[model samples]
Target: MPPGHVADRLAALVAERESQIVLGLDPDPARLWPDAGGDPDPAVAVLAHCRAVIDAVAPAVVAVKPQVACFERLGAPGWAALAATVEHARAQGLFVLADGKRGDIDVTATAYAHGFFDAGGLNADALTVNPYMGLDTLRSFAAVARPAGGGLFALVRTSNPGAADLMDEPLARGGTVWERVAELVAELGDEHRGPESGLADVGAVLGATQPEHLARARELLPHAIFLLPGVGAQGGRVEDLAPAFAPGRAAGLVTASRSIVRAHEQSGGAPAAAARAEAERLRETAWALG
Candidate 1:
């Protein structure tokens, strides 16, 4: 039999695990494991660090989100590292969400869609996509990912302080642009809803920092998964995100990057131990809200 659809598959995983925590692997060259030390090739150091993080945090997380920019900056080798990271995450039986935020139109977008396909080295359960250009630009991405049991997370309201400058600007049509984008995402997701899951494959990239908007966003995209970023290091409290689970606990994926991986610096313990502890704390806290 064929694999289950991506939307239903993700929902099942979340339900089975009883956890919605997504681990963010954003390895900085400056903060790599002490032994990753002194390497001229940043990719080498990054790869070593990522594998270790995956090993350390696997048990506590339901998924792994590898930052594409961090690896892409290292050029070809960085690409190699990202591919390896995705493979390792899958091997550990965790879902992989490629946090690349890719956006384009026509042929260019098609090429990008191919990159995230399961047949490629960068195969991921889902990919973070940008819908700034237009909702139409996202068509190709959704087209490719959906059929392959993969999905896309289109940015709606981002976590960065600067996001308001563009995403929050009011449009003549009414409300902020992000609100309009949310509507589009809802439609896209609905079009591809899983018959068994009652969820959509086109998820949204929402920020945990703006939890207040969660209710409204939910009103618009009831079926799409909301990838809530900015928790922990970004000062987004998990308590404020209950609305994201309005659809169900499995509907929201709370993401944390520097917070878990670098917890040892502030909490004081072995890096791996601190990271695991922090991840468990987050998982427990989030699971309680619903």
Candidate 2:
């Protein structure tokens, strides 16, 4: 990796924070905290809710993954809110991973990259991408992101049960579809491996709910960082993800959204306090595995 590669930066942050937990910010207008304040505009309220959550959990997490659709659904105001939320997370010293899952080829793919990695755009540290479109599409996104010290996390085996419909299908070439994608992830990330961290700027989004697939993913993409989602509300346990940390703690980032943000609902306390506690708990659990 170069001096300021995204993988290096990410590993540095993980070490500094002593945590690999990524706070997932998928705020919903209807689900805003009771004390998220009395903003009349839904977009503004959503931003407040996100900021509050970030403030509460920032100390325990190294990054935040904001689901783009949550903000995009509200139109222009929502877009602005998303930008503001990203800024706020950065202000709190957290890496921002824009969860857009964008995919395309040629100019369209480049456009998505700019929208997330450029100075005038979200300028996120990383973005989730869909690799179904093939390597050329990934190369296009990386062409833009890598130079900017940003990274891409390609979707691999996801947490959804329906993922089995495609990802688990046996290929005529003698491997599952997701396994092939993992090989591509490894191939594309090969040249961008970070020297200090030994992690690639290109990473994989491996759902934590599917712990069984982790060892295989590691075998194929040894140098890639793994973004493990589906924890908390998605029924994934941090204890089951031991294999993902084999490459190092920063190699596996465990993302939890509802479990952290909506923690008060189950624990019975102020939203911020509950969120902070839950995030800390996750941080400790994941850090121990490392």
Candidate 3:
């Protein structure tokens, strides 16, 4: 535990920022500026790209979702880039969400918690967790995050195309697997809810691609902040995400990466200019709905 509840912390930031757009930081070395770099180590270029993206979109975003796998793929250097990125994003007054989707039992889970919490050095405001291992796994994470004012967004329903194979499968008990996962997240949110924000430290990662699920997921976990990914390039319209804002203006978060960062592809302008413009566009669109 660090100090306050992450749910409330996020709510305050959202209100102040007046933007629910979460900038997704997925840096692909091969696609970086110049399309080719002489920086012997790709991670170096990756770091530069990440920083530029942050600088470009900070004004229109409330947080940045750094795909952990991108940095982790570079081994030690990649990990260092991740830490640097988190630090830089924080310095810019932007919230950081570590999108590692880690899950395990006992020490492994505990260790993962440390990485997401301030002590482990990741210093992320919130982490995305995989709850398939069961509630016990989530409990371990929540225990470490709660007192720190950090938060967790357990994977209740993901945005991947194949997610329905498991998440939408029918269970003997009733409803789909995702529905059950929603129930667990809702319970966790209720239990760890912050009185001030009327929100839970636990959150959910439901796909923006599947707008139908938003209403149901919100119904299940009213206080849990919904991190709806797969917007922008994935064809998820911002206008269809109204239900996610039912809990309050801060309840739903719409995330975009390539669409904003790669806007130059469509606009034929400088990377920074295109990114900032796209981010601004998204901000106004989502803010209006809120």
Cα lDDT computed for each candidate against the true fold: 0.87, 0.93, 0.87
lDDT string for model 3 (154-175, tens) is 9988888899889999999889
lDDT of 1 at 52: 84
Say which candidate scores most in TM-score: 2
RMSD of each: 1.6, 1.5, 1.6
Q: Which whole-number lDDT from 0 to 100 does residue 15 have in model 2?
A: 98
lDDT ranking, best first: 2, 1, 3
In model 1, what is the error at residue 153, expressed in angstroms?
0.2
lDDT winner, 2 or 3:
2
lDDT of 2 by residue, 84-121 (tens): 99999989988889999999986899999999999899
- Candidate 2 error regions (>4 Å): 1-3
Better by TM-score, candidate 2 or 1: 2
Worst 10 residues of 1 by lDDT: 33-42
**Residue 270 accuracy (lDDT) in model 3:** 88
TM-score, prediction 1: 0.96
What are the TM-scores, per candidate, against the unseen true structure? Answer: 0.96, 0.98, 0.96
Between candidates 1 and 2, name the one with more favorable lDDT: 2
Each candidate structure's count of clashing pairs:
0, 1, 4
